[model samples]
Target chain A: MERGGRFHTKSAELLAQVTWEVAGLPDPEEERKRQAAEFAALAAQYHPHPPLARNLIFAFLVGGSICAIGQLFIALFQSLGMTDVQASARASITLLALGSLLTGLGVYDEIGRVGGAGAAIPITGFANSIVSPAMEYRTEGLVFGFAARLFSIAGPVVTFGILAAMASALIRFLVTG
Target chain B: MVTGNAIAIRQASKRLGHQTMRFETAPAVVASASVVGLREGQGPLGRYFETILEDERYGERCWEQAESRILKEAVNTALGLAGWKEDELDALISGDLLNQISASNFASRNTQMPFLGIFSACATIAEGLLLAATLLEAGVAARVIAAASSHHEAAERQFRYPNEFGAQRPMTAQWTATAAGAIALGLPADGGGGAGWGAAADGSTGEAQLLPRITFATVGKVVEMGQKDPYDMGTAEVPAAWDTLLAHFRETGRDPAYYDLILTGDLARIGSEIFREGMRRRGLDVSSRHMDCGVLLYRPEQDVHAGGSGAGCAASVLASYILKEMRKGRFRRVLFVGTGSLHNPVSIQQGEPIPTIAHAVAIEA
Candidate 1:
């Protein structure tokens, strides 16, 4: 009786296989893909969209304000009889120092949060990117922690910035010649 | 037509089905403790926590050390509440969200108990509870401690950015909670209470019905459906949670209505909504009784984005609010489903999909 039951189940499975082969139904892989796409769409519906317009306005205001502050510093230095180039350089240095000081005081991050890329696209943001990692890794000791990680975030920016500057200089040299 | 040997084997088996385990004697959770940092202390469930630190550092030198210190404090506090000495525990099962589970290992070092560190990401506490209950039921141990913790700054530096690095987090991003929780489980006094068996010193009677018992556990398989977003872990974790919930209900011959509450660990807002919709599509409406630890941890104005997450998110909620409410006879039965995203920074950077898991433990008051 058990052998007969097993034979009956085997026949049923064979019949099902034949029917599946002949039915021209969607293949298992295609079915799986369709299900996955459907589920992904379902999940994506719930994801909250970030407020892009608000963020952009905030970034513009903050970035413009920083640049305005830099201009004020440049004007003050120029009033002291410095050259235009020297005044601008001094303003940049002053902004970097302020950024580093704010980061050390643990206030720049809050500014970054509010300003979005506005605070981040400025010289102050660059200073923050470098100083924060140094402060965070200081616990790993001065050598391996602070000094090594000082350039961890800013290293990419410096490397790429120098490369791009060289490329621009080459382009200018070729065009002028 | 079954043989006597076959009948004995069937009767002796602890497994209900393929994934669920039923203990012959359920282990009682005698005591539990939760410790949280300042941000979580200011959250909605803050008043329920045993220890709330004004400083996230907890007088420690670094965030990692602070996490370990809080975990140790939670374990000690749980043991103190249970009126059990450190020597009374046979093993400590704990894990945390750090490389090599460093926080748990450092915490366990001070515990001086036989340690078994586990990792299933945020599902760690449920995994630990399952193991502890299994150990107690199997007569391997009389008393055991299960704990998990996660620190926001420590995890952020390891997984995303430096604490002071100013980057705008997306709305889908969850704030990793700086919290720790520990639960002490032991065999019922009537069953395996050997030499050190005694009523808890908390003035409760020694009756088993008075304490919440870890009755059943359903182990989950890793489910990956090509979800790759690290910022949106709630969405990544929903499939695994749904898979585990389905398996638990099917294998255990139970339904959504079997438990008074179905608590999901850190599925937050988006994930919970997705989970409910998925369950509804499957003819099971769990919306009425569902609660998420991530959603419960913080208020909308906390700027936690989606919600709070981490191993400690669920652990702290369970050890504090859920269990406390259970003790007060508010909830009679609970299905604690811990959802976890098992992806690291390297894996995420490599564009690999997040493999997630969920472990469900049934607890009854």
Candidate 2:
């Protein structure tokens, strides 16, 4: 708030003026006129919905694309008469491996390059990080190799989830046993 | 014809407050005694550096960190060359590139002088000089030190990443190299040399740090070329530099014929040409004095695809070459402009062209 005798509104206006004075530029009125014109033209080309729309479409596309690959894995396992849970587990594993492969090859980043936010927000994105680096680190040694790292990221996630599941199991047992 | 005296050389600093934590400072002091955290990762050793360039290429980050660590060094170096103490001086005026200005805040933590913060992105160092000059001439304080800084790790984490799980980045998104920088200004009576940091001893009220007087800094005409990528900041930086250059010439009542050097912060190679051509179209001839910070760091052999950005690139170079030239009195006058593009992915994807800004300070040695 401004001190007494100087209105807050006027002080703000003055502060705006001071900014111009310091920059050695013209007064606010001139700049305002110039900005108004620039903004009017910009409004025509860019739409608020395009990027968001493009992204929504992309998420469905990539998510669908990955899901389709997962479906193929499921079909392969099911045709061989695997259990439903078995097929689902096998599909996730296949994707985890695939994600790791793209990540290692640095190809998934290419997809991200084209889609911007489109490829970014999906479960497959996480798969890429864990798998890619692990695969890249393969040359380091097998005791610490690619197959070993298949669980590097998944390792932590599973560990935490299992611990959480155990705690949840204990709580349920205490309440309903 | 000489306008001022002391020259600023070498700047470094650190940030202490706010990491994901919300901190508070007086509105006036907010700009001073501040370090910006793009994320908690920017300071000494953070994860962002590990993934981006690896340890072998940490030289740029080290120079950057040194640049951040040495704003006080540059000021003190100039002061050492000048020979002055804290109380013998007046106040410290400075700024930084953080959300809350942690760089200057952390920097001021070590010094005994008062802090006045500022924000003009890469232009703050020169802007700091201009402010220090104004105060010296205004008799606000007999001597004052001004400074500014930036960091990459912190900036990237805050602006780009909330989580690293597997975010794909764009090429236009130049990695904000991790580092810090600082500079000190003074207007002392005696020319007796040797002060903290290094001193530009020969400059009196008529030397680079003291006298030339910051008559004005041109407010740039920001142009949004509608480049949507948060990665391609050059689009905005080039125009800002070009616009600022034109504004500098027009405001000072001269053409490009007036300056021997016109330097822009962090515009790199692609930006340099765009800025030069952009200015040429305006009928402003810049045969000389048109250089970019991106051009100076590393050689073509280093293979930095797009070149460099980040507050340190310009601040460190300014501390080394430009400030050295100022101290030698090689340039009677120079126009240093720092260009920055205000951008975020949210805004870009919302289809907004990045709004850009540049600040210009004319110096005489």
Candidate 3:
């Protein structure tokens, strides 16, 4: 379904009444057709034609760099005598900290703007979601403002993640035990 | 000495002229005031505004309360300038970008006057004017205050995203103007003598009060071109603006050349181009005299991509810059087409397309 279809269906009845009153139209079908054509012409002229290949390359490069940094952090922590699992956890925590700091300093927004969803589909995006609303409502005070709104956007993600984890655990217990 | 035939002919009303309404007794804008925040005060038309706030909060606890304060200041200033008290006002028509129009509603609480809260998104000023003019022409209201306001932070949290999110905005995104504007509308005080608040009522300057009068109004139809991206609002609004302009011309039988200035509510830079190009193709080229309040509000160097927007954008510009220019005899006639994209964050998230509207009011000096 086209994006315009959503608008046309929702507004058709009311818009028909308006056009009839304003244009003094004799036929509703003809006016609707004319409007549809006009919208088509406008869409043809202004609709963005994204460069898929270029976008894919940027996404790969940015996404790979983020992962590479995480691996380096894990390796460095492991060399310091930590277990593999412990190192991985520490690396993820470090990345989350950096993402939150960048978001607070107003640098992450610029990167997300230029990189599009390339910057948003990563763990850094998760950190941003948690930090963003907290800072926005700081004026509302700590308890009702920052704390209450801290997980407004990321709360659903955390809820679903825990739910899925519990289900996986229950299945494993039933099959193996 | 006047003949009965002449009296009957004069009294015969032309109820419908195309899609427009021609007023027999046009309501005049006697006084107006504009109050803006720091960023807006730094814009190109900053000097013309009545008050420039150094702080967005205006000493309020929250951004919403700050917006309400801006509205109250604008209304009070306008009333004071017109030498009228709140008790004298027949009704107050106001709106804002906040949900339930809480900004205007809360601000009007102290006025103790009859309140009419309206919402047309960014086209609120024109809608307020249209309703106020209707009341004045019908003799239901001798004096009315029309106002609209918008606050960047309050609007951001409500309609878009959290301001602290540092979300990267697209180049198509427009900055909401943190401003409020109000205008006093009334007829000549007496039987054609033009005494109270007329052109000569500006006693401070010892010059005639040369106020602008709203002569005609064309209520716009909601038009949706199916552009759903909220950041690129100009695209969604252009078609509605064109529709209203076309309707106004068709109804009035006047071409683009009829007015010295033709202004759109807040099409900004990108939408203004689309509007001009679209009109050119239809053989109604208004590029020469066409200007947008969004484009004029902020300077290009300000980095307000696509320029300023919001209900207050056009309202502040009209009350401050445009009205002052008209009083100076710079423009004899003007047409203000206020365009609005009627969509909220919930609707956009649900994959709904934006519906748009534009209301036009013809003001003459």
Candidate 4:
């Protein structure tokens, strides 16, 4: 059977074919898909596209500043006689704490609103993803609410990270052997 | 189940055509009250709300509890304004944007009145009003209350991310209003007083023509145009609103000029524009007389994106601004089209397209 037709024409035909319809008729699924496509085309005209250039500039500045702050913490820790790796680890921990603190104080979301992906792509964003849900679900109780939901948003990241690491280890072992 | 008395007293058919129902004995909206959180209280319609809550939690322990408390407060305030006690009310119909509509259930539990819980997402207020008006006209009840509510924090947690979660919303996204509204409807007092049970303080009938009455209602069908973007619900809901509006116009033999104003529930910016374009395509121009509660609730500087939404968007606006203006003779006839996107978080996650519904209720003074 012929399956392609404009939505208006198909709909008009469908309306006319409302009787009995035990015989030849256009496929309902095809009609639905056409109608959906038609409506989507119309609706797309009214949907406003986000300003990508402005968001990119904001993200670059804000994300660069966060990294600069991380570098500052690393330098400070190294000045306290810590090794390079130890200083880097300590800086990460400090940033995580800062993210959690700002999230608790209800300020990180404001930064996110202005910074867009800049606030959402850093180590601080990871902390926010975990802490925000924990605080939101605290009213449900500690066991099921706080603990269970603590990683609800960040669980995929951890799970996929471990899986990717294992896969890479297997690939290295196979290649080395 | 049709007894002899049931058949004998059954008035002429109230069903006007396919979708519209004409209430022979129109129910009077006796009283209404709006209670909103600080954000909505600071919006454009702030001055019209009955109570502006300084605290979003309303001194409650949790956000869910706060939602229930606001709903209860709205119901109580409406009852108080109507001068009716709890026992005097016949039934309460209420809903909210929550899992299982727990807000309305908990609020009804506190009221201790016969309750019927309903859910139509944002269109719940109009659904409740239609049911309440039907109960009054059916001779089943004398007085009924219809209410709906939504909380920004509570709905955000359920439908999207946590309130404090850092994420940028798209321009098409609408902010769920933290508000609640309740309205009391009852049979008009005898002698065409136009005042409901408690309105005639001195037993004077001078305000006989002032009361706004629910005269017609059109129940909408679920219309799915396969729109799947959950963040862009304003566009998703336009087709349903258009369907119901067309059905109402066809069934009642009325045009856009029949009513002084046409109010849509929460179609916000894009949806309202699309609706107007669709109507114009059909040779009906409702641009001048049409307004959306979502657009009216907030100012552009409020940064609500598309605008205010949720069950409370329509309910709060209707209970406060629209009815108040109607009472002041600003509009004599109004058509309220409450639009709702019926997709849940689970449905959206399942990759199902969004389906929408709209219910239109006609009110006249």
Candidate 5:
């Protein structure tokens, strides 16, 4: 199907509605067809590649560079006598905090703008993912408010990942038995 | 006197038409317009060139308007199908071009749903959809949205040059078309689609529910061609698309025969050929109803620079073009694989490699 610029089709509908409402001219079918045709014709012109790769690199560098700073926290956890798991967990938290800070400072955004996936690649992406939603939830409340409400977007990924991981572990145990 | 007409319009609005959701939503697209052909004899908007191109403001203004329209429609349609209202949505997942992200950010400022800005290049659709599907399956939220947009002008100006750059266009660069798109999803629920997702919104009141869960999504490995040439995107991007498609098929352990249709996002002219050949070489016979959105969208005579790339390029194609075709019972199940070149020009300058990513999502008819 052609969702490419399909919004133009929506414009056709809006135009038709407008014409009908404005003139009451027997549904103004011609205008709808004309607008649709115009959109299609315009769309038919030569297309170009957007600066996607360029943006991704920028996002990657910024997000990744910033994330590198967070990675240092992992070393701190380890040197402070934390276990590997604890280090990793604490690292995740620190990364999340740094991510939120970057987000708040609007720095992560520059990374997003340039690196695209490069920034989105590492743990920073996930950290940004959670913090982004959390920041949005702030408008609603910190407690049982916007934060909980915001879970709908990223909530699925975490839940299913855990479930799937658990399921995999169960399968391994059953096989061993 | 001015107040009279305004009051009249407001009063009429209280009486007719479809119901507008009760949540705040804003426009998402942004652009800058300029005209040259007029001075040199191009298209007709020629005479009105100065009036239009005189300011990039209109172009950018129109962009967000279009983005908002398309984005909102996308979420609304999905919400409608799921029978959910705007107020119930948790947040929006989106990606686009621009550091400021005016299109997506401004768009979000008005939504009842919160926002997350993601930039996976054209992979934004797959990326956002991946997260959305993931969130839905976990029952974390009843409804969520993943959307992206790329303004032809904004992308061109920022990434390359003005429209006239077509003459100096290297084989490496492809053309960005003017388009925008958005999508929405709802999760499995006790009775309806889900808790936050309404079952009685818009046309969704009586529709069959969206699939129970998105189930699984595989983020692609960064595959790259040693060389970087914008002109020959086929060689550059073919491997990435092939890698992801093959991996997804492999992980699922499902034969290509099981799928009703398989599609790739924006693998235009050269890349399309490379993809087909690469698949053949891999010993995978996807000879079924497999096709590329780029090829399907236009007639060959209409030469796109290399092909089309943008969130809307595929989103619009999938939502409007493909959805329209689906009504005809063309296929029962389909796979939509979105490909992206996650490279930055800065990396190329720094002599870094061009890494790419592709994400795949399955749509059942």
Candidate 6:
């Protein structure tokens, strides 16, 4: 398959110190550049053009709506006489529960489909990732199916999150000291 | 007793039109059954399917196992409807979307018949039908069954991402159909001589003659047009579909107007448009008769972005809607082009271009 390359023969082995070199040396860098350009042209035709403006509007609206709902919950909690921190915590919990519930009921999937990253960038979307897998694997059983798959997507996030929190707390303590 | 089979068995003739095969004896689809999950059962052609599970699980351990179980049920239903016992089948050709086609293997294992495991990715149903017809044409098999299946969650987990990953699917991404379909092919029972099997043996004779027959098939070549995006599969597969359709027309000396309908399997909306445009460029306008199984499988409001896709997407739709409509005299001649993206997750990860193939089967009433 190597075109123009010299082939080694039985008779050539006896011709010691007389090397039969290839006709032309192939340049790796040059070949790579050519291939890259070819791929780029093909991709330009094959790859779908992103609708940046429309997507931006969708993301802004959906993300803004989710945050607005969260703020509403916070305001309601505060009106009920809870402290600011407690109200904020309660509002986040409510949003997470609603996200998981909607996901389990198959509504969040539709929302995520059209909302795109707008729906996915919020705290509820995180809850969706955790709940969606669990709901899908529910047929496997409660412990093995649901519980096992529940963390398949969120486990790494939790792992790094705790580690980062610990490091940040240590730095804060050292700086204060 | 002689089984009312055909009087003369022709020799194994090769090369029909171009890459097409003309069976000496067209194999008749005696019985067929389509089984789908809850989501698919709610689609437009839901009532046409033989079995619709209220629950997606169907009493299995996982989505994969559920897929296998439904496939087995579909095959069993087809056999039962044909009034043929398990031992009557000479061979079972089957496939699924799972690795090694385990769902089909599992389904076939239950029958204990001679099984052929085929994998054309999503085009497996068409591939199986062509091979089954070839067996009948060669006079090697009296009765044969071909089936294929897929589960949405199972296919997603294996091909793209885990359902729980909360991965945002692009608009171009398609939904994998959770369904199974089985078709039975056999010699004409009412042939002049009592040389073949018929209704007296199984009590399904009344419905035998109405079944659509497999008349021809064209095997497609693998075409790679340097497409790499896994999400946008339509652009990758449309070229292969167009190539095969052109080949079928060229080899058969026919035009797009020859068929009542020309359907492509699981191209969805995006691929369907590309296929139509490609055909138009080739001087064959098929927009009037052209339809896609992917786009037909779901409602727009269902939020299936590109449309439905999978081995089951074509298999179930053909077995239920197309065959039933043909039986009702809605279509006289139809061409089904089954398109498959023969790429694995590893291939996509390695940045290899997706290679695609499409097989066409001509079914006539």
Q: Please, what are the lDDT tens digits per residue for candidate 3 over residues B1-365? A: 76887555445643345467766688888788899989899998988888999988899988999999999999988887777788988999999989899999899886677899999988999999988988998899988889999998899888877765635566678999999999788885522212333332233354544668888899999988667889888778998998999989987889999999999989888888888888998899999999999899999988688888888988899888887777667888999999998998889999998999999999998
Better of 2 and 5 by lDDT: 5
Q: What lDDT would candidate 4 get against the real structure?
A: 0.89
- Candidate 2 per-residue C-alpha lDDT over B242-276 given as tens digits, one digit per residue, 9 for 90 to 100: 66666566545667667677778776665566667
DockQ of each: 0.57, 0.10, 0.32, 0.68, 0.01, 0.23
Query: Which residue pairs overlap in candidate 3's backbone?
Result: B199-B208, B199-B209, B199-B210, B200-B209
List candidate 5 segments past 4 Å from native. A1-177, B1-83, B100-102, B164-166, B170-173, B188-215, B324-328
Chain A TM-score by candidate, in order: 0.80, 0.51, 0.71, 0.84, 0.57, 0.78
TM-score of every candidate: 0.90, 0.56, 0.81, 0.91, 0.51, 0.77
> Local error of candidate 5 at B213, Å?
6.7
The C-alpha stretches of model 1 lying farther than 4 A from their native spots are A1-32, B1-13, B190-209
TM accuracy, model 3? 0.81
Candidate 5, fnat value? 0.00
Quality of candidate 4 docking, DockQ: 0.68
Ranking by DockQ: 4, 1, 3, 6, 2, 5
Looking at candidate 4, what is the lDDT of residue A147? 97
Cα RMSDs, all models: 6.7, 14.2, 7.2, 5.5, 25.6, 7.7
Interface RMSDs of the predictions, in order, are 1.2, 8.4, 3.0, 0.8, 15.3, 4.0
Better of 3 and 6 by TM-score: 3
Compared with the true structure, all predictions reach lDDT values of: 0.89, 0.54, 0.83, 0.89, 0.55, 0.82
Best by TM-score: 4
lDDT of 6 by residue, B1-365 (tens): 42333212222344555489887577888777889988899999897888889877787768888999999998888787666788878998999989999998888775658899999877889999999998998899988889999998899878875565446677688889999989888886723112222332233345533558889899999977767878877667887898899999998888999999998997888788767876887899999999988898889878777888899989999988887777656887999999999999999989999899999999988
DockQ of predicted candidate 5: 0.01
Model 1 agreement with the true structure over B1-365: per-residue lDDT tens digits: 97898666557877766688887798988788899998999999987898999999889999999999999999988887776788878999999999999999999885558899999888999999999999998899988989999999999999988899888999999999999999889876722322222233223344443468999999999988788989999998998999999999998889999999999998999999999999999988999999999999999899999998999999999998898778767898999999999999999989999999999999998
Kindly report the docking quality category of candidate 5: incorrect
- Which DockQ-derived CAPRI band holds candidate 4? medium
